[model samples]
Structures are given as C-alpha cells and as structure tokens.
Target: MSGGVDSSVAALLLKRAGYDVVGVFMRNWTEPDAAGRCSAEEDFADVRRVAEAIGIPYYAVNLEAAYREKVFAYFLEEYRRGRTPNPDVMCNREIKFGDFIEEALKLGADFVAMGHYARVRREGGRVLLLRGVDAAKDQSYFLHQLSQAQLSRALFPIGALTKAEVRRIAREAGLATADKKDSTGICFIGERDFRQFLKTFLPAQPGEIVNVDDGRVLGRHEGLMYYTHGQRHGLGIGGGFGPGPWFVAEKDLVHNRLYVAAGRDHPALFATALLAEDVRWIAGAPPDRVFRATAKFRYRQPDRPVEVEVLDERRAFVRFEAPERAITPGQSVVFYDGEICLGGGVIDRVRRPYFEARRSAFGDVFDRVLL
Candidate 1:
C-alpha cells in the first residue's frame, strides 16, 4: 500500500464491498540512509497504522532478494549500456504483482489488490486492462508489463476515484495516511539524489558535454548514466548561444559525450515513429494487426494517436501519427484504447530528424521472472 491515502482507501472500499481484504506493506529493498537506518520504516509504520484502523490482517514481506535479482540488476545493466531504465515498471512486474501476488495466493487470499490507478475487468471470460477514471493520476503506464495471469488475479479499488476523492474517503474512514505526502522518485530508492544513488552500483566515467551541431565542448558531465533524454536543469553547462533553455539532444555513449541543443524543439531529438521491443497486450493480443490507438512514450504524458504493428511474438513497434518529443530509450511506450490498456514496449529506437539514428544496446529487455 505504500502507506498512502490511495491504498488505505482501496482497503476500505474492498472491506465495504464484503471482500476479505488483507493489507500488505511490501518491503522491496533495504535502502539505508546516511544514518544507517532503512528509510522505509516511516511508510511501513503508517501502513500498519492504517491497517490497524481498518481492522484487517496486516503483514510486511521482504522481497529484497527478488528486487535485487530482477529489477536492480536490470537497472544497472541498462545504465551500463547507456540507457535510462524505469525501475518502477520493473518493480510492478517483478515485485508487487509477481512475488507479492504469489505470496498472497499462497496465504489463501482470493485476490491481490493495490492502490494502482488502473482497472481490470472480465468480458466474456477475457481479462481486459483499463485506465483509471482519474485520468490525471492514472498509473497503467507502470503496469504494462503485467502478464495475463497476474492481471486476472489483480484488483485496483481506487481506480474509480480521483486523488482528492481518495483523500476524502480516507478522511471519512479516519485513516491516518489521509494527509500523508505522496512518495516520490524511485520506488524503493525514495527521494535520495538520483545520480548519487545510482553511482553506488554504476561505474562513474566522467565525460564531456558538447553542442550537437558543432561538436564544441560546452561542459563536463559526471557520466552518461547521470543524464537522461530530456533533462534540462543541473546540466552544469554554460548557456550563451540560446534564446531559451537548452535540452539534452543526445547521449553519445560511444564517445562518452553528451549533446545539447537549444530548447525542447531541437529537430535532432524529436521523433515521429518509435520502435519498441518487449510488447505486452493485456487483452491477450491486439484485436487487429494494424490498429489505431493512443500510445504514451513516458509516464505522466497524455496519450497520442499511433498505429501498432506486431513484429513478432516477443517484439512490436508503434508509429506515432505526430512527432513525439523526447521519445527516449529505456522508457516504456504503453498503448491504450480509450481507457483500456492495449499494452506497450520499451522504446528501443527514436528516429531523429534528418536520418540521424539514436540507438542503444538494451532495447528489448523483458519478462525475466524467475520460475
């Protein structure tokens, strides 16, 4: 539940619906702070308090080994290949719905539920994934990697309400987490300096920042893994030749150089069509070979029109009808039909303007669940 208002209300709703709800606070990893204490103690305590208030069975599960093997290792491997990996997506697939769901089922629970802002429905014995009613807080993007079996056993009680409504319901129920601040940054990592946390596991190779067009040195970057596709601030690059703020145009890992250009509209970074790998469709498969749908290349982005093509059983690609800015590698491209989730893949290649190709080696990582 993450000890948040959303999950607390989810438990309340399920309890009111006559379902035997057990509140679980999953401990994915032990991230100790500068004081040598696990940072998750506060959230865990809050979740426990909410569970006590709700009068349900509450327990904490340690999945640190699973998280390290599945998500953290993959994160380090992706960054080693010069790509930004979404650890949250991997956490959902490997920890929450994967290990936690199995644990819940093993404990004789009928179903596993969470505070995710997405919905799952059964139509004619086929399971379908749908977006949350609260569009602004929808989290189906992080859930694209769920397998058919996991989606069938999953429940999302907060899918019907907005964030504000969730808070209200929690307040009405007298839950302690009603006013709790939302957890931000990497799921297990919390709000620590991102690059600093990553440095512990990744080898830091200092590199140079240069202008994309002229190849002139602008500044020095800590490493290629320290930056992402569309980052603007904390670049430490001096600005003089631009009218507006500059954005990272490209990361040339081969030469260990970063390329910056003026503004987010830099032609070299925007892409019309994106090639995604490791695609998953929650509705079994796409209804048609070439179907029009709404696709998002990053989390918190509005869906855009696109045509999806199944390249193979394990790989697929989507071509956006309009150019997408910062269609970055390592980020997931989740597809949707109205509010229903159509599935998506990791963005492998973003086609740059004028035929320059930005490529990566970690283009197709997927489904590494331990048997």
Candidate 2:
C-alpha cells in the first residue's frame, strides 16, 4: 500500500471479496529531506492505521539498497549523459515488479497486488495488460515494460474504479488515508526544489545558454542537467530578444552549451522520427516486419499513430505520422494496440525537423548530433 486512498480502498475491496489479503508496504527511500524529516515514516504510519482498520496484517519491507543499485543508479547515469530519464518507469520494472515480487513470494503469497491504475487479462493462454477504466487516470503507460510473467502474478484491485469512487470506498470504510492527498512528482524529491535535490548528487556545472537560431549566447545556465527539452520557464532569457519567450530546444553536451528557441512552435522543438534501444515486447517477440501502431512519447500523452520497423531484438525505429514536440531521449516510448500495451523502450535518439537548417547555420556546434 502507498498510504493513499487508492491503495487503502484496494486492500478493503480485496478483504471484502473473502480473499486472504495482506498489506505489504515497501519502504523504498529512507533519506531525510532538507528539514530532516523522513516522509516514509509518516506514510508507513498511515499504512499501519489503514491496515489495522481493515483488520488485515501488514508488514514493511526495506528495499532501499535494491532501489539504489537498480533504479537510482540508472537515473543518475542518464542525467550525466545529458538525457532526461524516467525513474518511475524503471522503478516499476526493476524494483516493484522485479524485486518486490520476489520478496512477496518469500512471504508465502501467491500473487502480488498493487494500486496501479491498470488492468490485466488472461486470454488465449497469454497475459495482456489493459488500460484502467478511468480514462483520465489510466497508468498503463508506466506499466508498459512489464513482462508476461509479471502480469501473470500481479493484481490491480482498484483498476475498474475511478479516483472519486476510490475515495468514496475509503471514506465509507473509515480509513485514515481516505482524505490523504495523492503524491506527485518523483518520490525521492518530495516538496523540495528538483534542481536543488539533483544538485545534492550531481554537482552543477555552469555553461552558456545559446540561441540556436542565430548562434547568439543569451545567458549562462546553472547546469545542463537542470534543464530539459521544451522547458520554457527557467531559461533566464529576459525581454528585448523578440516578441515572445524562449524554450530549451537542445543540449550540446560536447560544447557544454544549452540551446534555446524564441517561440513555442519553433522547428527545433519538433521531431518526425525516433530511434529506441533496449526494447521489450510484452508478447515476448517482435511483431511483423513493419507495422502500424500507436505510441506515447511520455506518460499521459495521447497515443499517436506510428509506423514501427523492427531493427533487431532490442531496437526499433519509430516514425510518427506527424511531427511531435519534445520527443525526448532517455524516456520510454510505449506502444499500444487499442487497450493492449505491447511494450516499450528507452528513446536513444531523435530525428528533428530542423536538423539540416541547424547544421548549416551552426556548423559543428552539435558535434555529438542528436539528429
């Protein structure tokens, strides 16, 4: 349980169904915040209260070491390479379903259940992952990397219910977490400034912020790690430049420079195709030689039509039917056929719409080209 209304209601529903429900809270991060407060302790306290109110036994398992080695190490490495990585996707794959499943089985459990907003179906001797009933809260995008084996042993008790329905169930049961606010953003960086938290691990290196269109230096950036593509707010580029604001277009790691475009619809922010590596297909193999499917470049993004070509077992080339803005590298591109989440991979590269124009204008600015 996550000490939230959804998980609390999930446990209550399972118990009401006459199943032997045991609440297991995984303590993933234990580091204290800047105020020297441990959020996990407060969350676990809520978990205990909910478990006692529901009359089910509960236990807390420490998985901090495994999380650090498996999920967090990759998160830091991706930032070091100037790529924005999704640690939640990796945490679900590596820690939650991977290590947490093993820990559950050791406790004599047949199935491991979570409060994920997704569903699983068994058909034709195959396990299929499906989007939750709540369209606005569907989380199948984050669970796209799950395997057949993981889905087979997993259960999502609250997948069929909406967020309001979940809170209602919790309130009816008199659960303590019925009115608890849902957690947002990265779990490790709770209530703290993201750039400040990141700087605790990765030292900030100041660099020049360059305007990609005219090759003019606009300002100095704190660090390339603190910015992301399509980010407009923190560019530090004030007025008098043009009639508009600026957005981060690209990161020139080799030159230690950050590139920005003047407008939101700048060509530098859009891409036509992307190359993904370390791909995984839920069906355990690739599909046809070339096939049309829908994919999400990021979580909660509407699925877009794409023609996927399998380059190898671990790589695929995806071309979007239309240009997509900020098709970032190091993020996962999840594929889907209707409600079925096929699988996903880490975005290794992108083919920008203004590649030729930037090359001609900036010459060797992007030596390590993302084109």
Candidate 3:
C-alpha cells in the first residue's frame, strides 16, 4: 500500500465494493541510509496499522532481488551512458505488474490493486488502458508497460476520484493515512539527495561545463550522471548579476563534458520527433500507419497532440505537432487517444533539423552514442 493516502482509500473503496481484499506492501529495496540520511520505517508501520484497521490480512513480500536485476540495474546502466532513467516506470512493469501480480494470483485473489490513477476496461475481447479521471494525477504513463492480461486482473479504485476526494474518502473511513503527505521520490528508496545517491554508485568523473554556442569552459561537474535535462541550477558556473539563468544544453558522455547556456529561448531543448524503443503494447501488437494521438514525455506534462507511426514491432516514432522541450532519451513517451492509453516506449532519440546536421557531420557514431 506504500502507506499513502491514495492507496489506503483505494483499499477501503474496494472493500466496500465487496471485493475480498488483502493489503500487500511490496518491499522492493532496503536502502542503507548514509551517515545523516533518514529511513521510512514509520511509513511501513503506518501501513501495517491501516491493514489492521481494515481487518484484512497484510504481508510484506520481498522483491529486492528482482528489483535489482530488472529496475536498479537498468537505472545504473542508463545513467552510466548519460541517459535519465525512470525507475518508477520500470518498477511498475517488472515488479508491480509482473512479480506482484503473479504473487497475487498465487494467493487466489481475483484481482491485484494499487493506488495508480488509471482505468482498465475490456473492448472487443481485449483489455484497454485508460487515463484516470483525475488528469492532474493520472499515472498511465508509468503503467504503459502493463500487458492486456495484467490490465484485466488489476483494480484501480481511485482512478475516477480526484486527490481531494481521495483524502476525504480516507478521512471518512477513519484511515490513518488520511492526512499523510504524498510520498515523493523513488518508493522504498526514500527521499534521495540525488547528487549524493549518484556519488555512491558512480565514481566522480570530473569534467568541464562548456557553453554550447562556444566551446568555452564555464564550470566543472563531478559527472554528467548527476545532472538531468532541463536543469537550471547547480551548474557551478557563476552568472553573477545576469539577465537570465543558465540551462543544461547537453552532456557529452564520451568526452565527459557538460554544455550550458544562459537563456531558455534556445531551440536546442525542443524536439519535433522522438524515436522510442523497447515497445510494449497492451494488446501485444502494433498498429499500422500513423495515428493521431496525444502524448506526454514526462509524468507531469500535459498530454499534447502528436502523431505516432510504428517503425517496427519494437520501435515507434512520435512526432509532436509543436516542439516539446527537453525530450530526453531513456524517458518514456506515452500515447493516448482520448481516455484510452494506446501504450508507449523509451525515448531513444530526438529528431531535429540541427541534430540531423550534427548526425550527418559525425556519421553513424553520432547516432549510436548520442543517446
């Protein structure tokens, strides 16, 4: 349940709907806090108490081994290659919808449920994923990896309710997590001081921060892995009494360098076409031709108009009608047609006119390593 207000209310809603419910707290990882870091033991305790109050059997299932191989390992690999990884999306795919669902089935439960704000439905004998009614908190992007089988057996009771309504439901039900703050960062991984977390796994590879327009050194960074796309602060480059702030333009993984510029007006961050791989469709098949839809590159971004064309079974190309900034490789690009989630994949490349010119200049190596 993650000891969150949403999940607790979801369980209560399911219980009232006459479903035989069992509260499960999946233990994905137990991070040893560094000298001054804090743990979330109390959060687990709170989840346990809520389970007791609901009179449902609760159990902690350890998924650490699977999490390491499937989620954490991928996360490390992505960063090592200078790409931002979404661990939550991988966790939902590999551990939650995969292993956790298997465990639930073994326990003879008819459905496995979670706090995700999304909907599931069956149409023409196939399961379809839908966006949550609460657009502000819709989590279908993270859930894009779920198969039709998983969708059929999953329950998202809070899908139709807003966050405010969820809190009210929890309070009226006398749930302990009624007023609990939303858990941030990676679940079970605790609140990460991100730079500190990277230092633990990736060795300090000090590099220069250069200007994208001119290859002039501006500052230095421990490693490119510590930074992400669209970051404006902590560049270590002092733009004292300037008219504007600097934003990260690029991270050269091979040369171990970062590029920054002191303006947000640059077109470098904007993308017209995004190429995605590691494709997973709810129906296990790709649609033919270009399909008009709406897509969101990140979880919080509003889904905007796009055209998705399947390049192959394993790859698809998404072209935004207008440029979307910071279309980072390794992040997801989830497609939706109305409320139904068409599915999504990992962003492998951004197709821009300038990028094409650079690719032509550098040849195949540029295409292979830019991601």
Model 2 CA lDDT for position 208: 97
Which residue pairs show backbone clashes in model 2? none
User: Comparing 1 and 3 by lDDT, which wins?
Assistant: 3
Q: Give the alpha carbon lDDT tens digit for every residue of 1-371 in model 1.
A: 77888888999899999998888888877777645667578889998899889889888888889999999899999899788888888899888989988888888988888999998998888778888888889999999888889988989999988999999899888999998888777765665677788888887999888777666787888998888877898788665665537688777676787877777787766777767877777876776887888888887888799988887876776777887787788889998888888788887876665333322321222112000
Error of 1 at 227 (Å): 1.0
Model 2: CA > 4 A from native: 363-369
Kindly list the per-residue Cα lDDT of model 3 for residues 1-371, writing each as its tens digit: 87888888888888888888899887777765554444445667878888888888887888889989999999989988889999988998888989998888888888888999988887799988889999889999899988888888888999999999999988888889999888778754466677887777878798988776656777788788888877887877775625447787667776787876567866656668878999888777765567888888999788799988898877988878997777788899888778888889998877755456565543453465343
Question: Which of the numbered candidates is closest to the native, going by highest TM-score?
Answer: 2
Candidate 3 lDDT trough over 10 residues, lowest sum: 362-371
* Model 1 RMSD vs true structure: 4.6
Which 10 successive residues of model 2 have the least lDDT summed? 362-371
Q: Model 1: residues >4 Å from true position, as ranges? A: 35-37, 241-244, 355-371
Clashes of each: 0, 0, 0
Judged by TM-score relative to the true structure, which candidate is superior, 1 or 3? 3
List clashing residue pairs in candidate 1: none
